[model samples]
Target: MRFSVHSVSLWLCAIPFLSLVGAQQYVLHHLFDHTNFFDEFSFFSEPDPTRGVQRYVSAFEANAVDLAGFANDAVFLGVDYTTPGPWRRSVRVTSNTAYDSGLFIADIAHMPTSSCGVWPAFWMFGPQWPYDGEIDIIEGVNTQDKNKVTLHTGPGCSITNEGTVASTTLKETNCNAGDAYLGCTQATASNDNYGDGFNDIGGGVYAIQWTDEHISVWFFPRGRIPDNVESDSPDPSAWGPALARFNGGEECHLPDHFKKQSLVFNIALCGEWAGRVWGDNAECSALAPTCDEWVADNPDAFAEAYWLINSVRIFQAHEA
Candidate 1:
C-alpha cells in the first residue's frame, strides 16, 4: 500500500554473540527516511498520514526541544529533547523487535525524562522475551536516583528490579535468581554513570557491547565519549569497568538471537513502568506536577515535552 510518502531507513546489527570483527556487517531493516528529517514533519496527537509507517507517531520536535543547556557544536537528531508520546514517535519502527550484536550504541541527549507513566527506554530485545532476550541499556522506574541496566534471558525471560548503576558497582552473581540465563553482573561508576546518573549527566552516550564470553555496557558524557565507538566495538577499559559482567562466560547458553532490527525511541506516557511509579494517580506529587499536565498537553500542543534528536547513526562491526 503505497501512501505516496517516502520511507526512511534506520539500521541496527543483530546477532547472538558478536565479536568486533563481525559488528560492522549489519544493516537496517528499512531504508533511511531522509525526507523525515527533524524539520519536515509536524508533531501530532496521532501518526502522520504521509509518514508511511503503519502507526502514527508524534515525530520529534513537535513536543518541546529546548536546546539551551546543550548549545553544543553538533546537531544531534535535529532536536534536543524528545517527542511527547502515548506511544513511540519512532523514526525507525513502532512495534519493536530484538537483536544481538557485538556492539550497540545509543547516543542520546535525553531531557530530565522523569514523568509519571513515562518510560523512556533506550534498550533492545529478542523476539519472545526471556526465551529470546532483552537488554535494558537504559531503563528506570518512577524516580531517577536509582537506575537499572540488566539483561533478561531464560527459557523465556525475566527483568531485574530497578537499582542505581551510576556507581557502576552492581555485583549480581546471576540473572533473576538463576531462572534461565547462566549469570550476570554490573560494573559502573556508582554516582555519575549508571541509571539516572547517566541521564542526569546530560544524557550523553550509552553503549552496550556483547560477545559470547559476556555482555557489558559503558556510559560517556557528551564530550567525553569518543567517535570510534560508533563504528567499532570499544575495548571495555574506555567506559567504567564494564557495567554488567554476566557469568557463564559463554557457557550460559544464550543462543544466537540478534538479527537486523529497527531502532525504537519512545516516550511512553503513564503506562506499565510509569504507572508503577505513581500509584492510583496519587504519586503525581510536586516533583512531577506536570505528570498529568504533560499527558493533557500531549495532544493539545501536540508538541510539548518534545525531545529533539540530533542524529541517529547505526554502525555495524565488520565481519571478518
Candidate 2:
C-alpha cells in the first residue's frame, strides 16, 4: 500500500502551530489485562440483588435514549457481564473531561462489521460534541468507503485532508471555535478506509497522538504490529506511513482547546452516523437496511456484529 507521501508533507506544511508533547510520562490507571478491581472497570454499572428499576444507571444522560426503557442500564454496557448488551454490547469509556498527553488504545476485534446500518465506533469525545470537541479516532458509517479519523470543534477550527484508497492524514486548527461545536475530518484511509477492506483483512488498531503542536495517528492490525511498537507513543520510527493529514494553523485559535477527551467504545446501531448510511433506520424501518435484516440473510456475518473487545489499554511515556 503506497500512501501519498506528497499528501503527508503537504498536511505537515499547512499546520502553522503544533503540540508535539511526544509520549505520555505518567499512568492514570494502566488498564490493559486486568481481571477485576474498583478502578479496574470504574465506569459505574447496575448493582446486583435488585432486579427492577434499581438496576438502571440514571447518571449519564443520553439524548434520545430513556434510561428505564431498555432491559437495564447493564444492557447498555456494564462490567458485570462479559459483553455489554442483552444481545450485544461494546464498552464505551467516557471521560467528562479530555486527557492532555496520555495515549489511548482500543484493541477491538470486530465481527462481521460490513453489514448495513451497523456503525461501531472506537473513539472519544468532549463534554459536548463540536462544542467541547469530538475526536473520531476510528469511525466509519455502514457503507464503508472512507475510514474517517476526524476532529470536531466549533468555528475557530478548520482542517485540510489528503489521502487515497490506502490511507489519509489531516492537520487542524480551531481559530474562532465558535460557541457551537463543529468537527473536521483529520485523517482517513482511502483503500483501507473503513469497510470490507478493513474487516476483511482483519480489524486493526487506531491511535491518536495529540501534542501541543500536532496530532498524528496510525493504524495497525494486531498481527502487523512489531514487538517494539507495542507501547503507546509507539516508536513511529517503525510506524507505517500515515494515511491522512489535516492542517490547523490558521483555524485553531485556542491552544488548550482540545485538552481532555474521554475514551468511548460503542456499537451505535443505525443512529446519527450509521443512520445516515442505510437511512433513518428508526424512522424508515421498511426502507432502512437495518442489521436485523442482515442477521436473517447472513447469519454468519451478523454474528460478527458481536464486537469482540480483546482489551483496551492506555500507556504514557516519561518526559525527556
Candidate 3:
C-alpha cells in the first residue's frame, strides 16, 4: 500500500504494568532456516502492488539467474546487478502458512542498504486487503537511515504508542486505510536499526510479539540479543521496552483488526515511495533525473541490494 507522511502532534503515555494473565508461554511452532526456507516460502511472481519498476521473477527464473539461492549458509535473495532494462529483476517471497497471535523472529546477516531507488521491507498482511490488516515490521525508502513501523487496517482502528521506547516517535494514530492508506506509523530513533548502519553491525535480529492486547517490535544488534531469544524460549515480558509498541485499548480492538497474517519480504525499486520522494533526497536526485531512470541505468549501484537471512522462527502460546 502507498504511504504518505504528515505532521502530527507527538503522543506519549506511561507504560502500564503487565498482569500475570497478560503473560504468555510460547513454544516454537515453525522454523524457516536456510535448509528449508526455499521449500516453505513461495516466490510471488506478480506485478508489484506498490507499482515498483521491478519484475518479480519465479523460483525457476530466480534460481537460474542466481538471484535467489544459498550463500554463506544463509538464504540469499538478490536483485539483478548485471542487466539494464526497463524493469529490473528482483524477488519477493511469502510464507505458505498464515498466523495469528505469536512471536515472530528473524535472524539476518545482511539486507539491502539505503540507495537511490531501493525500497525494502519485512512485513505481514492478511488475505483481504485493508479490512484484514497489515503490519510493517521493517520498512524504509531511499536514503532513510532509520526504520519505520506502521499498521494499516479498516475503519475504527486507532492506536496509542504507550509502551515504546522514549526516543521513538509516533507519526499518526489513525490506522484506517481509507485515508490513502497512510496508516499509523512510528519512526525509530536509531540509525543502527536499519540500512547501511545495520549491516555494518552485522545485521541483527528483529523480533515482533503480537498478542490479543498489543503488538510490539524489538531490535537487537549482533552482540546484544537476549539469552532467551538465542535459546529459543523467548520471553517478551523480560525483553524490557519495545522499540515500537502499538496498544489496543478503548481506541482499537487488536484481534478484530488483525488476523491470519502471512509473512513477506521483498525489495522494490523506484516504487511509489522511493520515486515520490526522489527529488527531496539531494544525494539521489543528483545521480539522475528520476528514480526509475536511475534504477534502470545504474545496475551496479544495486550490488549491495540483497537479503542474507539466517532464519525466521515463529512461536505460539502453548494450548492450555
Best by the TM-score measure = 3
User: Model 2, 195-286: lDDT tens per residue?
Assistant: 56665655566655555545556667657866645653345445555554444465464344565667655444444455444554333355
TM-score of 2: 0.61
Better of 2 and 3 by TM-score: 3
lDDT of 2: 0.44
Estimate, for each residue in 1-320, the C-alpha lDDT of model 1 and write its tens digit: 00122223223433233444443454322111232323222223364322221122344322233211112322222122233444433322232333455555655654334444344555555656455566666654444444566665653222231323344555554454466343244544444543345545656766665655456666667777776555434444444455554433333544443333334444454444454446545555543454444454444322222233444444444545
Show where candidate 3 strays beyond 4 Å: 1-23, 177-180
Winning model by lDDT: 3
lDDT-best of 1 and 2: 2
Tens digits of lDDT, candidate 3, 203-225: 99999999989999999999899
What are the RMSD figures for all models against the true structure?
A: 9.3, 12.5, 9.5
- Candidate 1: misplaced stretches above 4 Å? 1-98, 156-166, 169-202, 227-240, 256-262, 280-306, 311-315, 318-320
lDDT of each: 0.43, 0.44, 0.87
**After aligning candidate 1 to the native by TM-score, how far in Å is the CA of 129 from where it should be?**
2.5
Q: In candidate 1, what residue range of length 10 has the lowest lDDT sum?
A: 1-10
Clashes of each: 66, 62, 0
